[model samples]
Target: MEIQENAALLLIDVQKGFEDEEFWGRRDNPAAEENITALLDRWQETGRPVVYIRHDSVVAGSPLRPGQPGNDFKELVEERRGKGTGPELLVTKTVNSGFYGEPDLDTWLRGAGIGQLVLAGIQTNMCNETTARMGGNLGYDVVYALDAMHTFDLTGPFGWTATAEELTRATAVSLHGGQFARVVTTAEVLAGASAS
Candidate 1:
């Protein structure tokens, strides 16, 4: 895997709200935060651009809603803010796709001359996946860091439930091989960075 020197690391919806197992069922990828933190550190160290997306849920009582403690970024991610030499951008969005966020992610990326994106964060099949698809469609090289993302179990309309691990695997299958993004492990991405 080749990661461009200027590729922006998009950390989507890595907030404390995702830690609420009571609100969001059991989740897969227990080490997701550690992986994300590692990638963030490397990107900052190498001076690669970084973007953080926060989901501000519109649902009246959602954990991610404004004024909720869950809306804040996790401590590890928050600690690295403004520590990187590369530019940092924060995008707040109510929708699943980070591209639709305020200040306009696409516009910001375009203005910054970024044409490649590396994605990681919460909800493997939700915000992260949606953002990857959008980034691909918009002609950016999108890399999906599978191991750096975690997702909760989901229940369908028919009441059939899917395990978080199953959903995460499905997300990887659907996004890999030029569909929406290139799905790779966190180590793979970090190695690519180191190689570059």
Candidate 2:
């Protein structure tokens, strides 16, 4: 916590595509939207820089395909957007990492003099994790909001299917209290940012 003046909030892929029941629905962390909303409110109140990243899937007919309704932020998240206060920047990328080719999130952060990033949003083990890793590698101190990220149950080639909850927890354990990032609750983040 305790965001520096040069700190910015990076909200990754809180899109309607993920929130839609027909799409990649059923997340492990249902509270992610609420947590992200709380953080957004606090960031708005403090006038801290808030950056929103939207993922544009390159695959045709993907839920996040450009110009689709699902590409927009979900209802809960949409409530946080406007001209007055909330997010200061909205960057769209086709890759899992926001720093990838696209709107140049890394360059924007650097231009804003941001050395610290508070990250939150969907798919804890994917987009969120990738962004956090990239941020850490790029020399930014990252703080991941534990309750503000989520993922879906995943089954791959290992004959093992991990629930979203398990993936989220494991990702947090690996990121928090480590060199990558500090994982903290929304309360801790709010208090720290406020105090800062």
Candidate 3:
């Protein structure tokens, strides 16, 4: 689980929209913010590359609409800005996949010779899952932090409602053991990064 010198952290959509207590307030992935902050601190100290992706809703007047406060990175993330050795790269995207039809994250990663990517973010079943799949298909060594991603209960077409804990655990199970990516705990990631 150790992060190599060429490793990078891809933090996806830890935005104010996802942190809105009034909306998605019932989600059960409570460790997400703390995990993300811990990883951020480790990445900053180690001088590893950290790339942030912010989701922008294409629909006008949505919570994540452009220029809205909700579209910005959350307070925890904003506080760490400009404190790292290098400038933080921020990619804004209109779709679930950050690499889809926009800033070309794959190309950028390849150009940087980045082979390992550690992913942490919000909405585990949506943006986080999509990005991890894309990163795996693109040949990056992907590590998904299980406790560092959050998802809300979702009602499926058959009227089945998945609870928040169900969604989080399901996403973790889907990502772990090589169906898509390796799932690791935040503590594991931080320890590995520190040892690297």
Better of 2 and 3 by TM-score: 3
Which is better, 2 or 3, measured by lDDT? 3
Sort by lDDT, top down from the best: 1, 3, 2
- In terms of TM-score, which candidate is stronger, 1 or 2? 1
Best by TM-score: 1
Measured with C-alpha atoms, the lDDT of residue 29 in candidate 3 is 68
RMSD of 2: 1.9
Q: Put down candidate 3 lDDT per residue, 82-133, tens digits, no spaces.
A: 7887435778888898777357788878888889999999888899999988
Clashing pairs in 3: none
- Per-residue C-alpha lDDT of model 1 across residues 28-135, encoded as one tens digit per residue: 888998899999999999999999999999998789998999999999999999999899999999999999999799999999899889999998988998999899
Predicted structure 3: lDDT = 0.83
Best by lDDT: 1
Those runs of model 2 whose alpha carbons end farther than 4 Å from true positions after fitting are: 83-87
Estimate the TM-score of every prediction.
0.97, 0.92, 0.93
Displacement of the residue 127 alpha carbon in candidate 3, Å? 0.2
